[model samples]
Target: MNTVPWLTILLIVPAAGAVVVAALPRRHATLAKQLTLAITLAVLVLAVLATFAYDPDKAGFQFGQSYDWISTFGISYSVGADGISLVLMLLAALLVPVVVLSSWDEVDGGGAGGGRIPAPTATPDATGGTPGGSAGGPGPAGDVGEIGAAGEIGGVGGVGGIGGVGGGSGGTAVALAAPAPAPARPATVPPVETRGEAETHGRRSVPAFFALLLALEAGMIGVFAATDVFLFYVFFEAMLIPMYFLIGSYGPVTEQAQRSYAAVKFLVYSLLGGLLMLAAVIGLYVVSADNLGHGTFDFATLRQMEITPGVQKLLFLGFFVAFAIKAPLFPFHTWLPDAGAQSPTGGAVLLVGVLDKVGTFGLIRYCIPLFPDAADYFAPMVLGLAVVGIFYGALLAIGQRDMKRLVAYTSLAHFGFIALGLFAFTSQAGTGAVLYMVNHGLSTGLLFLVVGFLVTRRGTRDVGAYGGLAKVTPVLAGVFLIAGLSSLALPGTNSFVSEFLVLVGTFTANKPLAIVATCGIVLAAVYVLYLYQRTMTGPVVHEENRVLHDLGLREKIVVAPMVALIVALGVYPKPLLDIIRPTVTATYADIGKSDPAPTHPAAAHPGAAHPGAAHPGAAHPGATHPVATQPGGHS
Candidate 1:
């Protein structure tokens, strides 16, 4: 018994922090921001310690914690991590503090509504006197939603969302031109009475955005950490709620429709998958109850139950639907580009970086072991789809005008390689797929953050809208360039190492598929360089860009760690591969026992019917009499 339940503490602390922030008084906004920052930083430190404390030499789930919550129903509160889960968990923890601090000024602003308050105002009384003298308007940094939308109003929002600007009036002009109606003046009642309270209330609600994001973090971590099958399903469905709110409430106005549509699509797809998996889980429990003597939803217990081959296929399909929808694999991946393009960069970072890994992770952790026969039967088709996704995603990314969507599509291509490596069933491929998860999070997350910062400065997500940005903001352009190169898997970047391993292992398993996938790498270079050319290499576009500042101190801080990780992992990836190899080997061994037998008697039990062969009973004493290692023969 491991006395310290570090995993549980890791989860509970964040949930508690979110609750504290959500309940904080409006007057204590600064305190709320600081407290939330402190909590997120604390979680990050623990996650690091958890990584250090993790005994890679140990065989299975370490830091295991379990408690029966509904024993009668075979349900329990459980959390644990293997190498894969630990890596993803650490990524989540690492990003949370950065996200919090990046938005600190916005979420913790004074009552004047500056710094991310879109509709900031200072109210006046009956005499038109300022309630608080000279409350400066929100600076160039508007609300995240407002700033993210920038210049896409006509095409993105159908022109309704962009309030007209009175030229040459600066911030005050834009503020005065807002679409809201003027206050109804009364001789007896002051005009300030009408607008002041409304404005104040709006300012107080900014913290809710942070609360929503924190809640999303909690749900995402739980999904990665869940141990029991039913518990996993529960956390799986719970994630959509917070993500739904994150997009619908705090999301950018220009992409509002696209964001809402993507969220609903995600919800519907995920729900259908969940329901199918739920049915399969129940069916498995019923079969276990009949044969294994009692029902249980514990993954470990379920793993040992001897399910029939046909039944395993059905169960596998149910789980595959859920994971595929989450993975957004090839044909099922339509929702990703839209969501990634429309979501705030934070949302997109987590979406592409961490959340997508859950899908591929499920294939390794659950599907293959739980239904080995089906996995073997379906291997070729899965491999084909992975190859298809690679070429298809890269080809589409080459045509993208929206910078964010281009990044999203590139991820699709990257995931395609990962999926291919995984189902290839080679140990090296599997290890590479696992490592790809961590590397993708680092590289893609950095790319999205850097892109968001550029969009903030340029006021557009259009790749063509930017040019010669390196000349204007050298530091930012350099960060963007490095991030793009990492995305392209250039030599000495983390993605390069993982992707190379995947291609190498995949080639060993499926030569033609690997060859086709190599084409995707070429396409990656084309689009990455093309994107950089469009955004950073040409003549400077509008005069507005001439004086744009370079990467700010906080922005640099947010990105530096990710850059270091990418470079470090690229230079030396052996440590991650070493940790993953043992587990991958064990998983394959567990499932390798499910290989099917031949139908013909002579072929099925070739050794059994041969003359002078030793009795099969001599091989296994525990098996009833003599269980046949040979196919289609009774012991």
Candidate 2:
């Protein structure tokens, strides 16, 4: 029964719910919330069951389902999950429901920080005397003062299930990296704000946007599950529409500078990457036809086709570029922080939690398997870049004033770790990278949701403005502590287990890189502790902060599950590792057999002319060369 094409149902039900949600009467807020929550919850339940039912020992796609879609091109409405896709899909299904619930009170405008799109022009009855209505700007003078107060009476709400997990050392290190906030310079909003019109159109076109979100999900799921290259391209290209609306229309504080800039930047980068990938995909299909006697976009077929080393190197660039931008790796990563900081909390959650994983996923699924030699060839450069991202993102995060943007840069660091684990060429690293993707989604998504609440109440994203908040909102403080700690890879938390695996695996392959990566763990503590200290510690200085409140039932319920998983996965990672290990082992075996050993300078010098040329048998003119074998080893 579990094998009955569950992926299709997982993709379709939310889509159907979007339709149901739009048709309901505008006044029926309760029904809308209930309907959306129920649909997302159902998806979660199914996805969970699918995860359990999945056979990790299996070497190929399972719960496989296919139906002809574009017969002429051999495209099919097909879906399946291997260990990699299983974890990612589970990540998506788990978070969407939580995000929905977190927004229940806000969208309904019935609880703390209540605000929704097409914000009521006049103060509504449900706002409970909160001033400034629902544009979600600062409320009365009291609300403004509360923003400045830190250690006042417990006015903020508790984060129920998501708080109280351990691993504080790891998480704290990341948070304490800096004390000051980035200077706030006013943004230049074009007088016309053409983006504003698009947003208005999107709000009026809620049904359309919702449909697009579902469609995006469908494409993302397909991209992960696809066994065929052309099918992957089709789904990959389809993702842009929903994301465009999610950024352009449903963004938080749509009138702000970040929103418009993020939306446009995201579109340009994603589209450019897609076009380059499209050319590569077409080229691969043509090559397969000529070489293998069939024009096929199937992943299995392409993997078996033996293209020249030159072809692999060139083609790898096209695919790698696309995936890196999606992964938003270091240099290509400029657009992500902006999109994450300004977009709706839900959009940000999905973008970081689920979508970003696609890039790394592509690395494992397509890059390594199809271009093994190229991947081996490029390993050093990739590892170097990953290291840079880890440090650069942490430094940037430490300097952030906006809490949302802070969360965004931290994710960049996290992605760097995941990428390092992946290209490090150890099975342990690969499994860790896969599991990290799941843990990141759960933890980061929760962080964004919680921060959204903060923004909702305070009308600002500035960290310095908040002082000793633990006294006012111990529950929120606890929630932030857990989420921040998890981000920092605290022990007894899910992130710790995966991060440990990555470090352990990376160290096994490259000790110096591992040592450098460990510095990121320290940086993690610095930024995370700073975030916690600035927001939740100290005395409540502002007079207005004296009356602020803490977490209510709705917020508690939404946060609890995510926090629970952080603990569960942290303590009992064996279950997840057990599943991921087998698949990773199989993939690495395939890749390793085809590619030569990656040669770092240390391996190449054996007491050579310089430390950079540490290995004796370096190959290729590219900077630290990769060698097929040790100079002393038998052929």
Candidate 3:
């Protein structure tokens, strides 16, 4: 048994770092950010070290530590990492630093209006009528007065301004209609602009943002490292708080109400799922009490108990529903689009990349092993949902106008592929599903980061706003194209390998379903390539796009590692496969299933004797009959 409490240390470092960073003086925003980055890097180094120390040949969970807590209710503070948990921990660690570096200038308060654009001056009509209205008529309905220099809107028809109508005759000058002075930028609140567009954005609290980010990291790590079921649930629900604030406080939308609405919606959906899981957890304890003579929340111990089929089904739905919502599978997925579109770039990366994986991970970790019979019982329904999601999400992705929403939709489809593989119940499919989780994080995380870079430069997420960006920002375009290609599972990119494995494995188990799921690949191609063509090719129709600069040094640093990993994994996935396959095999074994033997026909060798027939002069009393030789030595 390993003596070091590696998982506990991993959890504490980030939790403690968040507290420290949050306590820093407001003026030390830079220091807070730097410290946060250093802490994330440290976590990454530790994760790497833990990876090295792991023994894949071992039979069960490694680096495990357990201590009693809440003994009356059979709860404990236990932590450990299997292969699946370890890789995910590494992914979260790797992406946090990248997010921080990419968002370095995202919240620096400086420049005109603290990086926000001054309100545009209204243009007068040809007849010199009131600005933004017909001559001698009321200004366009619902038009507010110009924003003042201090970022406040001037009141209409007040002491300092005229009414909706300019009170001027045709071809006459309106003396009272002077434009409002520009707003003064606040020193402490920096605008939430991307790196290059720091000159024109609104201010958000930097220290608060980083602090929330660190807190989120702690929660994510905890969820994966946790060994106690109740503890897992605790970490699962607790992570939502930081993400709620991150989305509500730092979203790119200038309107606070919109951000708040998205945040609320996300919280509501997650909380509902959490409630279901909580009930199931209580149900599980009751069942354990009856079966084991006492209620306990230990995951391994619970896995050893055999519950009746009916109770297993009921408990399964509770946990499965929660994970599905987290997975945001099909109908449960409505909140993700809004959340992803509204969140800031870094927030979006973690939201979709690492956070959503918790759902699928739960399905593998808690749902299947603990309720094997129920998992099998619900397999058909889940498979149907997975196939539907593949088509539905892909079609919507193709139709989306907003860049971030489009990416969000694509994840919905990718999760479908993951779900399909997991339920297929073969080691190959299960391994592919876990690998897909890691690869999706890298590919889609990179996509969100690059899109964020574009949004920073252009200050918009509309797909229509860009045309021939490659003309000016070739490097950015290149990265975007790579990310897009990987998303579509282009043959040479990382997603392709995992996606291919998923299909092949699914094919072995359910040929018809696998065939139908394959069409999602075509739809994926349409959305990914069309998005690239529309945004990066053609004439530079908008002049604003002409002057956009390519990726700067910091931005290049952000993308290079991701791009390298995508290509490297695409070409050779053996290392990850080696780490992932054993756990996948064991996971499937837990449910009493194994890989199905292939049914393809094999050619008979010329002049070979039929095996069941006794060989000439070789048959004798009590002699064993020789078996027919086939490919792989299977009869």
Candidate 4:
């Protein structure tokens, strides 16, 4: 059982596959892609099987394994999962295959409008395929349109592909509180000639692209499963390399803008965060050495020592800032939009969906538990930032031009909600926070993946260029709608459950913050629906949009599982909730907080007469009356 080393296998499988793919001959790219697929799928399978091996009843780490990796440094290779980590781990395992499938055609230069790092240079026509269409300039003949509900696509980002998804041309266009008038037509979309549907131009580089994907997967899994602080830092830092390459190469054809800037920006931000964390790590080690007689980076060992409040706060900032930047919380969120906008769909998928979550995860799994006093002390300030991020991100999303960037901004808002729940210091809120991370990954991943599909067809990421896309691509539009609905946390979608729990849980602990955070949901609805309406609804503004293909078999295969999970988790979240609740309760104990009881009117007014007193023997909700005192004063 314990001898099986399941977690180790999960880490090694994809990592080993990456090496194998890298070694394969470049000419055999198709074969490399196949091999990479098989390997990723295998890892996904193992992660699933590993789930069965997990015990929900175990409130502490499960399937624990440790080995002395660097004994002199007091470092060890320790790996395990609890309810919180398990859900996130499963989310990672689930997304990799889907990401692979979604990218199958995209990498080959299919219908992406724009949002890639540059593969090898294709000609202008090869780039856009239109004679006059320069990289950043407008195309001569292509139907450039406007996207977004308000007036033109100027204020909001280019979301112009709508009036087809149920937003009719007349009044519906202005329904989302558009203070401006709808322009007669979409703005000029660059005339990038889309390669016909059957095209397969970039097949040669498939292997290299997929190899990087596998590497990223391995890093993601390792980061979440890591139990030792030093080991966690290793994986945390290791993931950046693959992502850097993914962003630098194999990206969308932005007209003239180079993905190099985005890639470098992402790297610098990440490295800065890592440096901060490394300092904290060294500090933690030194403290342990001075007090415990040995320096150790084991999460368990670190928690055993009682750090002073001052030192805890200082260490907490070092770690918190690292996680915050990684979380890309409001002020630190500048890099994400650029990365999301410039990186290719597959790269963006892992980048936004799974990779960024490392920030939030670290806060819960490391920072708070290791520095409970600091976590409690900074709770109010953190909660304020979370609320501000929620509103701020949604507003920015509502104004984005690129679909990728819009989705990216929305994540900023969602992350705010997740952070709020975690810092609120209640079991329900914290559990909801963990659940939100899982659900956000799924829902947002779906959104990004669908946007990738549209970009593929249009050869442009401009929303305005697409009008009545639903008419031409029904299934694609439907998928977009569902994904959008999920993003808005619709009642029947998985996001709703988590959002509700966070708000409810936060309400019990911090009513004012919870109330303010609730506004995020409303803004979420506005931006989500507006994006969908602008892109998928209305009349077909562009004749070019009319001929685009619908979601292909591969694309459907990519999206189906995510959609299933969204609805399935929405209907009944117990399985996930069951796995999450115990670990969350444990986290509560780690941070020294209790789940506050929901306020009751009766409890609030002990002096009031119990209604049952007037109907002592009648049917009642509580079925009790103040028989002892006749005024609900039983005591």
- Best-fitting candidate, measured by TM-score? 3
Backbone clash count, each prediction separately: 0, 49, 13, 42
Worst 10-residue lDDT window for candidate 3 reads 626-635
What CA RMSD would candidate 2 show?
Answer: 13.1
Give the Cα error of residue 224 in candidate 2, in Å: 2.1
Candidate 2 residue lDDT tens string, 1-635: 65577777777787677667767665565677676767777877988888888876566777777777776666666667787888887777777777666655543233333322232222212212222212222111121111211211111112211111111212111111222222121133223121112112111233443444455566666677776677787778777777877786566533445667889999999999998898888888878878977677767667777988999988999999999999979989999988997677767888998889889999998888889899999989999999999999999999998788899999889999999989988766777889899999888888887777676555456787677778988898899899988999888899987888788678768889999989988998998888888888999875545555677777788789899999898887877776776667667776653123445545454555532342535221111222222111000
C-alpha positional error of residue 26 in candidate 1 after TM-score superposition, expressed in Å: 4.4
TM-score of 3: 0.84
Model 2 vs. true fold: TM:
0.79
Q: Kindly list the per-residue Cα lDDT of model 4 for residues 1-635, writing each as its tens digit.
A: 54577888999999999989888876776788788889988998888888888777655677678899999989999998887777888898889988887776566544333333222232232112212111121111221222223211111112332211112322122222322322322224323333221122232256778898999999999999998889999999999999998777666433214567888998999999899999999999999999889999988778868999999999999999889988878788999998887777878888888998999999898888889999999988899999999999999999987778899999999999999989987766787889899999999999998887777666667778777888888998999998899999998999988888788778877788888899788999998988888889999988768777887777778899999999998888878877876677676665556755425655335343542222334232222222121110000
As for lDDT, the candidate ahead, 1 or 4, is: 4
- Model 1 residue 115 CA deviation (Å) reads 11
Q: Rate the local accuracy (lDDT) of all candidates.
A: 0.68, 0.69, 0.78, 0.75
lDDT of 1: 0.68
Ranking by lDDT: 3, 4, 2, 1
Clashing pairs in 1: none
| Better candidate by lDDT, 2 or 3 | 3
Q: Give TM-scores for every candidate, taking all chains together and pairing residue i with residue i.
A: 0.80, 0.79, 0.84, 0.82
Residue-by-residue lDDT tens digits, candidate 1, 1-635: 34577788888888888887888766676777788778888888988888778766576787877899788878888788777778888888888777766555433222211212122133342334322221111111123112112211101111223222222212222223333322222233222211111121223245566666677778777877887878888878887887776555444543445657877876787788789888988987788788778777777777777888898888888888788878878878888887786565667787888778888888887898777888888888888888898889899999998888898898888888889988887655776788888898888888888776666555567777678888987887888888889989998898887787677666656778888888888999998899889888879977756766677777778888888888888887766755665566567666663212223455335365432122333221111111112211000
Off by over 4 Å in 4: 1-3, 110-204, 601-635
